[model samples]
Target: MGLLTNLKDSVSRVTDRLFASEDPKRIGIYGPPNAGKTTLANRIARDWTGDAIGPESHVPHETRRARRKEGVDIERNGQSVTIDIVDTPGVATKVDYKEFLDHDIEKDDAIRRSREATEGVAEAMHWLREDVDGVIYVLDSTTDPFTQVNTMLIGIIESRDLPVLIFANKIDLDQADIDRVADAFPEHETVPLSALEGDNMDEVYDKIAEYFA
Candidate 1:
C-alpha cells in the first residue's frame, strides 16, 4: 500500500474505533497564565498509547493561539475511545494585546485593541458558559490560587456547572505545593503533575476518562 493509502486506512480505523465506543467526550483544557495548560494537554495526548495529538512547549503562554490534536483509536478495557483535546490560551484578567501598548503600539491602534479585548472577554465567557464540556483548570502549584483571577474562574465554572479537574502543574518546581492549591479548590478533583517530566499523567488519563464515562 502507498503512503497516502496507508494513512487513509489508519484514519478510517481510528474513526471506526471511536464511533464504536460506549460514550465519547470532547474535553477542553483551560487555565490562567503560566498554568502549564498546554503542557498538560500535550502530555495527555501523547502519554496514551493512542496517537498523540498536539505539540508540547515549556514556555508560558506558548499556546496563546488555540490548536487541537487528536488521539486516534485509544482502546482501553475492550472499549475504543477518542480524546478531542483543545489547547486554549491561558485565561487572563486583561487582554494580552495590552503588552503591545507598552511595546509602543500606536495610540489609535491600542485603543481599538482595548475594545477588542472587551469582546474577547465576552467570547471567553461564552466559551465557559456554553461551549466546553469540561475543563482542566491548571494552577501553578508554587503560588497561591485564591487570587481574584482564580476565584473568578472558579465562579465561572460553578456557574456553568461544568465538571473541572484541577491540574496542579509544575510540581517539579522547588516551591511547588499541591496541598495548598488543593485547599483552595476543595470541591473539584485535584491531580498533582509535572507536565515536563511526564509525572502522574496516568491519573489525568483516568480522570478525563471518568468524565467521559
Candidate 2:
C-alpha cells in the first residue's frame, strides 16, 4: 500500500508540473514574525540575480508589506526554472504596538507599523489563496514548532493542494532542532538551514527545481 501510494503521488506531482503554466512560478515565503522569511527569499534572489529582495531587520514586523523579486533564473542539473520570489510579511493573529517598543521603535511609529503589520498579515493570507504557486513555510528551529498559526497555515496550504516546502530556519542556533519541526508537520517536507549563515541553501534550490519548477 505504501509503495502504491508513493507511486501515485509521484505520478501526480509529475502531471501537475507538466501541466503547470507560464514562465515564472510564484513562490511565497511565509511564517511567523522573525522566522527569517525575508532573509531566505533574499538569499534566493542573491543566488540567482545578484541582489537581495528587501532589507531585513531584527525588529518584528519590520517587513510590513509584501515584497516580490521577479524572474529569478535558476538552473540545477540542466533543469532551468524562473521564479518570482514573494516575500510576505509575518503571519500573526495579533499585532501589538508595544511589542515594537522592545525593538526601540517610537510609540507613533510602532503604532503605525502595528497597523500595517495587521494589514500585511491579511494580505499574506490573501496571497496564499489567490497568487502563490508554491510556498516555503519558514520556521525558527530554535522555537517550539507547535503553534496555532502554523496549524492554520498548513491547513490552508494543504486545502489548496499546493506544493509546500517547510523550511526549518535558524539551524545555527544551539537549541535548533529540525526533528521537532519535521514532527510538527509530518505531512510536508522540511529543510533545515541557517539563512543567516547561508547554510544548506543548495538543498532548498534543489527542492525548488525538483518539486516546484
lDDT (tens digit, per residue) of candidate 2 on 80-154: 888899999999998999999988889999999999999999999999999999899999999998999999999
TM-score for model 2? 0.96
Candidate 1 Cα outliers beyond 4 Å, as residue runs: 1-23, 49-60, 71-78, 96-123
The candidate 1 region of ten consecutive residues with least summed lDDT is: 53-62
C-alpha root-mean-square deviation, candidate 1: 11.0
* TM-scores for every predicted model: 0.71, 0.96
Q: Give the lDDT of residue 124 in candidate 2.
A: 97
Backbone clashes under 3 angstroms, per model = 0, 0
The digit string of per-residue lDDT tens for model 1 on 1-213 reads: 377965774576457555645544556777775688777776666666444445554433445455666553455566655666766676777765556466467778766655564554455556677666667788989988988878988888888877678889999999999999989987777899898798887676666655543
Instruction: Count residue pairs with overlapping backbones in model 2.
Output: 0
Query: Candidate 1 versus the native: TM-score?
Result: 0.71
Residue 150, model 2: Cα distance from true site in angstroms:
0.5
